[model samples]
Target: MEFKPVTHVLFDMDGLILNTEDLYTVAFQNIVSQYGKDYTFELKLKLMGSQAHETAKIVVSHLDLPVTPEEFIAQTSKEFEKIFPDTEVLPGARCLIEHLSKHNVPIGLATSSSRESYELKVNKRHKELFSLFPYKTMGSSDSEVKRGKPYPDIFLVAASRFPDKPKPEQCLVFEDAVNGVKAARAAGMQVVMVPDPRVDESLRTEATLVLKSLEDFKPELFGLPPYDD
Candidate 1:
C-alpha cells in the first residue's frame, strides 16, 4: 500500500523511546508477587498502552488482586521513583529525534504517561532530547484525551497541537504496542512499530512497518531526509 508523504511525526514514550518497560515489569512483579501472581508478557501487553488508572484496574481485575486501584498506583509510583531516574533512552531514539529536528520536521510526543510519570522517566536523564519535541501530549493528564491507546484520542489531539495542524494522513506515528498501532491507524495515520521481540508476530500485521529497533528505521522510505552519517 502507498502512503502519503509524511510531513509530521508523532512518538510514543515508554517502550518506544525509553527503556522503562523492564522497570515496569520489575515493579509489577515486585508488587504482584506478594499475591502469588506472575507478571507475564500477556499481562504486560494489556497494560502497555493503557492509561494509568485503566492499567491499574486491568491488573487488579486480571490478577484478582486484593488491592484497590489507588493502592496499586501508590505502590507502583514508589517503585518507579526508585528506578525511573535510571531510565535510559532507547538506542537510536536520540539520533532519530535530532535528525528530524535538524531537518525542521514537525515532531511531537504522545505518551500514555501522566505528566508526573513522564517527568520522572525522562526529565532527569534525557531533558535535552525530550525538549526537541515541541508538542508533548501527556494523554493521562490531557483533558482533551478522553480515551487511551486503541482509541484515536491521543494521536488526534497530538496532531492538532502541531503548528500547521497536519492531517492524519500527512503524519506518521512511531509506536511499540498493539493498541498504539491500532490507535494510530484509527486516526488515519501510518505507524511504524518498534515492538518488543516477544510480541506476537500476528499482532504486527497492522503496523505500516515493523522494526526490531529504531536503529533500523529508514526515514527516506517515508520521504523524510536520510541520515547523513
Candidate 2:
C-alpha cells in the first residue's frame, strides 16, 4: 500500500526503541507466579501500551491476583527499577533514528511511561540517542494527554508539539503495540507496526504497514530519505 508523504514522525519508546519488553515479561512473570497466576500472551497484548497504573490494574484483574492495583504497581515498579536500566537498543532502532535525524526529519517520542521511568530507562547510556528527538510526550506525566494508548491523546499531543504543527495525516507513527496502532489510526496518522513475533497476525490489519523489525523498514516507502546501506 502507498503511504501519504509524512513531514514528521513519532515513535513509541518501550518495545519499539528498546528491548524492555523482555525485561517487562520477566518482571510480570516473577510477580504473577508468586500468586500462582500465569502471565499469558493474550494478557500481555492487552497490557501493552497502557500506562503504569493501568498495567498494574490489568495484571491484578486478569490474573485474579489477590492484591490492590497499588500493591501490584509497587511490586512491579521495584522490579522495573532493577531491570529497565539494563535495556539495550533494539536492532536497527539506532540506525533508523540516526538516519531520520541526519536527514533533518522532525522526530519525537510518544510513550506511556512516566517521565521518571523514561529517564531511568534511557538517561544512563542512551542519552545521546534520545537527544535527537526535539520533543517527547510522556502520557503518564504529560497533563495535556488526558488518556493513554487505544485513545489518541498521546499521539495527538506529540503532533501538536512539533514546531510546524503538522497535521496528523502528515505524521507517521512507528509502534509495536496493538493499542498503539489503534491510537495512531484514531489520530488520523499512518502507523507502521513492528510487533513481536508472538502477536497475532489478525491484529496487524489496522496498521498501514507491519514489519518484523525496524530492520525491515524502508524509509523511502514513507517518502523519507532511503538508508545509505
Q: What is the model-wide C-alpha lDDT for candidate 1?
A: 0.94
Error of 1 at 94 (Å): 0.8
List of clashing residue pairs for candidate 2:
none
State every prediction's TM-score relative to the real structure.
0.98, 0.97
Candidate number achieving the greatest TM-score relative to the actual structure: 1
Candidate 1, residues 48-126, lDDT tens digits: the string is 8899999999999999999999999999999999999899889988899999999999999999999999999977878
Question: Distance (Å) between predicted and true CA of 132, model 1?
Answer: 0.4
In candidate 1, what residue range of length 10 has the lowest lDDT sum? 1-10
Worst 10 residues of 2 by lDDT: 54-63
Local distance difference test, each candidate: 0.94, 0.92
TM-score of 1: 0.98
Per-residue lDDT tens digits for candidate 2, residues 116-227, read 8899899888999999998999998899988789999999999999988999999999999999999999999999999999888899999999998999999999899999
Runs in model 1 with CA error above 4 Å? none
lDDT of 2 at 93: 94
CA RMSD of all predictions? 0.9, 1.0
